[model samples]
Target: MTEAAARRAPTRAPEQDPGARGGVRRSSVRGQVLDALRAALVDGDLAPGEVYSAPALGERFGVSATPVREAMQQLALEGAVEVVPNRGFRVARRGARELGELAEVRALIEVPVMLRLARSVPAGRWEALRPLAEATVAAAAAGDRARYADADRAFHRALLGLSGNGQLVQVADDLHRRSQWPLVTGPVHARRADLVADAAEHTALLDALVVGDLGVVQSLVREHFAGS
Candidate 1:
């Protein structure tokens, strides 16, 4: 197995062995494969528009093709990949325009909510999200795109969750995930310094919100989405 695949492999407890619980073991393997595939997509390990067979991925992960196929089907549903008849799955080809649209939609939904939160939510509430913001910075500094993506989403989710609207959070999260997909024609991985700068924006936004600076909050939010 590849080192990346090895790192992503799930460790089973003795009682959860395949022999003792075949179905549970399969499900666990499938879930791990799904997560690994998503990480691969975010990290640009899976090239856009390229078809990849389950057996090929299975060999790389040192697992049977069944779990890989199941995970690819889930990715299909997520629009991360598409079925290719009898061949395999092709990584979805996302372009700059699609990414820009996703960012626009996110800003439409989140900007107003954040502005409102800045006015109503206490400074302590904004302060509480500092750890999550810092996590993104750490991940960016480590040059780990997958980890940075996860941290970025967590920070946004937590910030949006403050609205107390489950549906809004779900919608915003979907948009956020799509925005993270790499563009097919440009540099897949961002420069480490760019990642660090982007991560710093979270902290800057929080600082603006804490001080009840609506103008600064609005400007930061719009500029952030524009950069996305």
Candidate 2:
């Protein structure tokens, strides 16, 4: 290799590809480890306040300790997990104020970006959004708290897809994934009516998108996140 090539950082040195969806490319052992660990973290497979055993997790993912250690290090950097001294990685704890701030920052970054990506928001995008929003509404109506939360998460993910910036979508996902901590802190059992109302508000946001109403859409986003 030339001097310049030698000086370059070996990003893929050990066969890890953290590439985005489409080229999704979750092919290598390291990539599999990272993706599995990330899924477990984000999907509440490892619940809030649940301590993760590095070796146990490695066993479940069918890998050895080394890659699990590396993945845990990366997750810690991403704020998905916390590194406790001599205790390995633990799920990060968060409170209501922190969750609300996360949603606020996501709105601040994403609303404008979504407005810009409005042209690509496709005429049929609302068709895709409707079912997810309805699923949230139905879950809320049925008083299924966990299912409601999952549906709520799906609604946000669909909204993130509106931005069309693969990287930016992950920023919003990171913020929301951290939200589950506080999401269950309150009386979600008593909040079904409120959640249903939130789903209806999403309908309005969908309508705003349809009409290309940037101001109203941004306002709706702020209001929706403010209650978090």
Candidate 3:
């Protein structure tokens, strides 16, 4: 072939990089947007029952509307938001009754697990979780609701993960996330004192578990869920 003709062959489109198709990159952006949206929900930045447009959220996150829409779709699937067709998404309005029901269900599933772990798992294991518990306290002390929520869930997930039951951990994590969402009315944001108090419970619960104090563990678990 002539050299000119060879140069005109366009180099076979450079083998079409996989991420260039928007698969990996788009998925990463969507995941980030989803996480940000969830944090907004937990921080009460996204008020319950209030409508939010994809473009507006995208502006806030400094991304295109496509990824924001994709993220909102996932949130909708998780019951965190509802579609509004041609408008935007509306954050799900959870009432006191629903929150109470979630707390009760969580207590039912987690209390027994905590009690079992307290009796069986080594004191060292419980002690090892001290960092996670402390992380919650640090986040709470900073008055960062979103950070506290993440730390709180991480601590609980670590605690339940000791049960060696993957399904149980997943179920409990879902309920925990739902419970962190702000309610439709009354106390949209947690006071710094309330957050600090809640975080302190983690340390106290860990202390109880470390010493195998089943009674204290049980009491703390119930009170934690009740106040949550």
Q: Candidate 1 on 30-92: residue-level lDDT in tens?
A: 888888888888767788889999998877666778888999998898788999999999998
Per-residue CA lDDT of model 2 for 132-223, tens digit only, reads: 87887787787554566667778877887776677877777777655644334346455767777887877788888777777887788778
Shift of residue 5 alpha carbon in model 1, Å: 6.2
Query: How many clashes in each structure?
Result: 0, 0, 0
Which model is ahead, 2 or 3, in terms of lDDT? 3
TM-score of 1: 0.90
lDDT of 3 by residue, 99-203 (tens): 999999999999989888888999998999999999999988887777788899999999999999999999999888888877233452447778899999999
* C-alpha lDDT (0 to 100) for residue 215 of candidate 3: 92
Residue 172 CA displacement from its true place in model 3, Å: 0.6
C-alpha positional error of residue 224 in candidate 2 after TM-score superposition, expressed in Å = 1.1
What is the TM-score of candidate 3?
A: 0.87
Model 2 per-residue lDDT at 225: 74
Whole-structure CA lDDT of model 1: 0.83
Q: What 10-residue stretch in candidate 1 is worst by lDDT?
A: 9-18
**Clashing residue pairs for model 1:** none
- How would you order the candidates by lDDT, starting with the best? 1, 3, 2
Deviation (Å) of 131 in candidate 3: 0.6
Ten-residue region with minimum lDDT total, candidate 3: 4-13
